[model samples]
Every structure is written in C-alpha cells, then in structure tokens.
Target: MTAGHCSDSGPFNSDGSVSFFHLPWGGIVGRRLIGPMARPDMSVADMGFISKRNPDIGVIPSIRNTDDQEFPELIIYGTLDSDTVGSTVCKSGYTTHVTCGEILAFGVTVTFLNGMEFNGLIKATHMSCGGDSGAPVFQFAEDILPGIFITGMVTGGSEEQGVCVIEPIAKLITDDIYVLTINDPI
Candidate 1:
C-alpha cells in the first residue's frame, strides 16, 4: 500500500509509472501502479494498489525488521478492537527502516502542510521518517507469528525521534474494502 498523499500527486506520465521496487539477488524489479485510494483531504484513507508483479519473485507475508535481511514470518491474523489503545506498535519503512514505539493517543487530528487534515489517527512515539509515509504498522506479540497488522500506513510524524501518526486499518475498511489474512488465498 502507498500513502494517499503520494497517490494524489499524479495521474501518471502517459507511459504509466513505476510504483514499487523489489530487490532480490541484488537486482531491482519495478512495479507499476494500477490505481490509488486517496481521500479528498488525504488524511484517513492513504493507500494504493500495485498492478505489476514478477512471477519469479517470492512475496512473503511478513514485515521485515530494521536489519532489512530478516523476515520474521509475521502474519496479521487479527486486529485490535477500536476502543483498544495505549499498546505498542511497530512499523517498517523506506527511510528509517524498522522501528517500534508506544501508542501515545488515539482519535487524534493531524494536519499537513498541504492544508489537509486527518482525524481519528493513532499517535505514537517516534518510529518513522519522511519517506516512510506508506509504511505498515503492526503490533508485535510473543505468539508464534511475529506481528499483527494494526494500521495501514505511517501517515505523518517526527522523523528525528521516530514519533508516528498512523492511519488505522479499521478506518480504511468499508463495504467494498477490507483487510485480508494469510489464510486467504492469493
């Protein structure tokens, strides 16, 4: 998934556009964007879909740790209830890589420089950066699975200390869209 703010930036350059990159065997494979789901203000729903995928490449359903080399085999089997708050959340992104922090508050409002404001966000300690806007947020537990997907992306926050503002996954689901689990077939 990608940030709504990033998706709102374009309709592509006629030739379409390279959306994501996959690095395997030290080589890069670029994926293209099929479409995006952006809110008018680009605050709550910040995600996009990639249209391209290489059959030869393996897609792991896991979040990579900061080390960038390890896949903990994490599976998002479930999500925390909405009223649940003040738990620890972790995320992996392009800029800061991987980091974990505590949830400081919920149902908060964050405003961007573009004059777009997002409400009902999860506020947490620092664990993200500028380029990490579309990173997934999860909760790590002692269970066999490494983590549980809790939110969609790291929408905003301080990159210096790692404070993060997240777009909760619950808020993203609708009558037509929902989160899928590993048990679901690809």
Candidate 2:
C-alpha cells in the first residue's frame, strides 16, 4: 500500500493504469493502480493499495531503519487502533529515512502547496519533506512487544516546519485487506 497521491506523481506506463515504484535498495516494483477515493476536498485518508503481489520478497510484517545500520528490521507484533496526544510516533520515508516525534493532534486537515486539501489526518512533529509521502507512520511498542505498530501513512508535510500529516492506516484497511502481524504465518 502507498499514498494515493504518490501514485498520482507516478512513473506511469503509457496507459496510465500502472506505476513503477523504485526501491532504495535498488529495483523497481510495478503495481496496478487501485484508484483512491474521489473527493472534492480530499478530507479522506490519502491512501491506496496495489493489486499486484511480489512473492520473491518476504511478506512478514516488519519495520526497520532504511539503512538498517542504526537499528535492525524487526517484526511488527500487531497494530494499535488508538493514539494519544503527546505519545511518540515515528515515520520512515523515501526522503527522510526515519524520524520520530510526538503526536500533536488528530483529525487534522492539511492543504498542500499544490492546493490539494487532505483531511482525516494525524498531525505530528516528525521532520518530513517532499518525496516523503507514503511513508509509514508507526509507534514503537517495545514496552508491550518487541516491534512496532503501524498506525498511518504520510500524506504530506504541514506548513509548520518539522510537522507532517499522516493518514491513519485503520482508515485505509478493509475486510478484503489484512496487515500481516506476528501471529500470521510468514
């Protein structure tokens, strides 16, 4: 899954029905576009999923530093549905790699420089910039489990420096979609 707008930017095929996602580790993953919600103001969670599957890559749930130098990739034990203000949240993006900050607000609506307005977002003090869209916003659950709980995907940055808006993962998930947790078979 990835930010819908991220697909909007695309390295699209001539038909525009598909996009190529580049990996920092070196490779390309072609994904079929599953169109995002159409809204006049974009108040909904800014996310979309790809229909294609990559069997070569491990499907185990995990999060790691982009470089895996500072911290190793760890399994995702499960998910957290609720978030509290002042709690720490971290994000890993194409541009920012990994950064953490406190949750400042919820149900935030943000307007990007492109004049695209996005709502139903979580506002955080994490440092972010362009190309960081579609990053994973997660919480470390070391106290309860030795893993992270993915909460949201980055929609974009806020006007305030060091702030970004995240679309809660819960809003993007559905009955047909299931996130792989530790309990799930790898």
In terms of lDDT, the best-performing candidate is: 2
lDDT of 2 by residue, 149-173 (tens): 8888787875557687788878867
Off by over 4 Å in 2: 25-43, 53-55, 66-70
For model 1, how does the per-residue alpha-carbon lDDT over 1-186 read when each residue is reduced to its tens digit? 566676555555455543445432223455432333433334345555554454565545566563644553467665554345567777777666777778888888877777777788888888755677878787765665465755656888875645788888787666976556666666
Q: For model 2, where is the 10-residue window of minimal lDDT?
A: 32-41
**lDDT at position 71, candidate 2:** 57
Q: After superposition, how far is residue 70 of candidate 1 from its true place, in Å?
A: 7.5
**Per-model TM-score on C-alpha atoms:** 0.74, 0.79
Residue-level lDDT for 57 in candidate 1:
54
